[model samples]
Target: MKPHQQGTERVITSLDWLAVLPVGLLLRQVDLTGCGPTCITVSRWRPGAGAGGLEGTGLCVCKEDGAVCGSDGRSYRSVCALHLRSWVSLQSGGERIRKAHDGECKLAPVIVVSPKKIHNVTGAQVYLSCEVKAVPTPVITWRKVSESPKGVKLLEELPGDRVNMAVQVRGGPSKHEGTGWVLINPLMKEDEGVYQCHATNMAGEAHADGSITVTEQNKSKKASLLAWDNPS
Candidate 1:
């Protein structure tokens, strides 16, 4: 097809040739034939229409378009790319594809903000928090890391009738994100250990760890006194 310059856009006059160019190259061609400024349109050729007739033509090119998500949970470089794929699929007798949303598709959980190490004295309250981002929203759970008698590591889900500890989770300090927190009131020596933030979704799972260190009230004061005396 021969494309002639029409102001800032390109217009294809001949429909005798079909080209399936790479997405990068097509995008770089600023003068790609298009129907409008925002989107690329594609049309199927009519069998009986002469090359001079623009009958049954529908598709255009959008060089500046952003990526789009497909209904099949995949990402396309642009709307034109998705339409091209859909056309190819239809020609192959496969399912027709449609646009799901703007932007790339996400399918896995990611730990955005991990909990940090904490040190506290006995009888003090402490909070550990974690944030995760994922598509379809992820479920956040808190777990305490423990060692078994056989030296294997174990993860115990938190807030199971533990009077001193509580866990809470909620969605979004941002889109597609969830935050979780574990509160330990009147912290004790037994509550000192590694805590895990576990996030799971239909696509996948993610994990992060935080720790708590507790000191008896008397021991904490004594240590402070020792540090003061040493001046180090």
Candidate 2:
């Protein structure tokens, strides 16, 4: 057989050399010399070209005036931005989307303005209220500063029932505020002392004090004289 001259030929042994688009689309196959239309994937290009990233796409505008701390431990410029970020993440099949909370993430304990000192006569009902503001919602406890070294006791931990007691502790009717303790029926002299309110949370603890003065009950002079003169 006579040998016939043939044109040079090329063979693409693998698709490994194909460039991968950011959205996971493979480039079109072509001859090694390279002359053909590029394969265009509308769906894959849509995400990278003008959709889904955190920047641009009008995804992070500050719709409202409040900032928030996301569960990811970062502060978002605004609530709208946070929600938008979450939506993008969910749409992109990224990590689970976490929406941010209303206020900046913080833990602070503050005692509202309460009377510095309160006076009540024997057998009078008095309420010593302490309002606390704290993140994570603090636990409210009332204690009396003791003259002895035994320290104070949580009012709820006091022995026996509070049905007939010098003091009783309770929470506020609404959780939006806080709690307090009441001196239900104070004794003439026994209940006179300094009381403290203790608030605790994951961040730490805080306390405030108020003085309670109990005055001696007054006895009528005529009744005293009559009792002395009668000598039953």
User: TM-score for every candidate vs. truth?
Assistant: 0.60, 0.46
Model 1 lDDT per residue over 1-232, tens place = 5556543334444322213333432222223453544454544344456685344334455655577888877777777667656666777899999989888787699999999999999999999999999987999999999999999999999988899999999999998899999999989999999999999998899999999999999998998999999995
**Pairs of colliding residues, candidate 2:** none
**Candidate 1 lDDT score relative to the true structure:** 0.77
lDDT of 2 at 22: 24
- Runs of candidate 1 exceeding 4 Å displacement: 1-68, 71-104, 229-232
**What lDDT score goes with residue 144 in model 1?**
97
Candidate 2 local lDDT, 1-232, one digit each (tens): 2222222112223332211112122222232343122222221223344455323121111224555777776555454445445545667786654645776555656776453688877777766778876666777777666554566443433213655344343555444346666555645566677777777877777888887887765644566788999998
For each of the candidates, the C-alpha root-mean-square deviation to the true structure, in angstroms, is 10.4, 21.3
The worst-scoring run of ten residues by lDDT in candidate 1 lies at 22-31
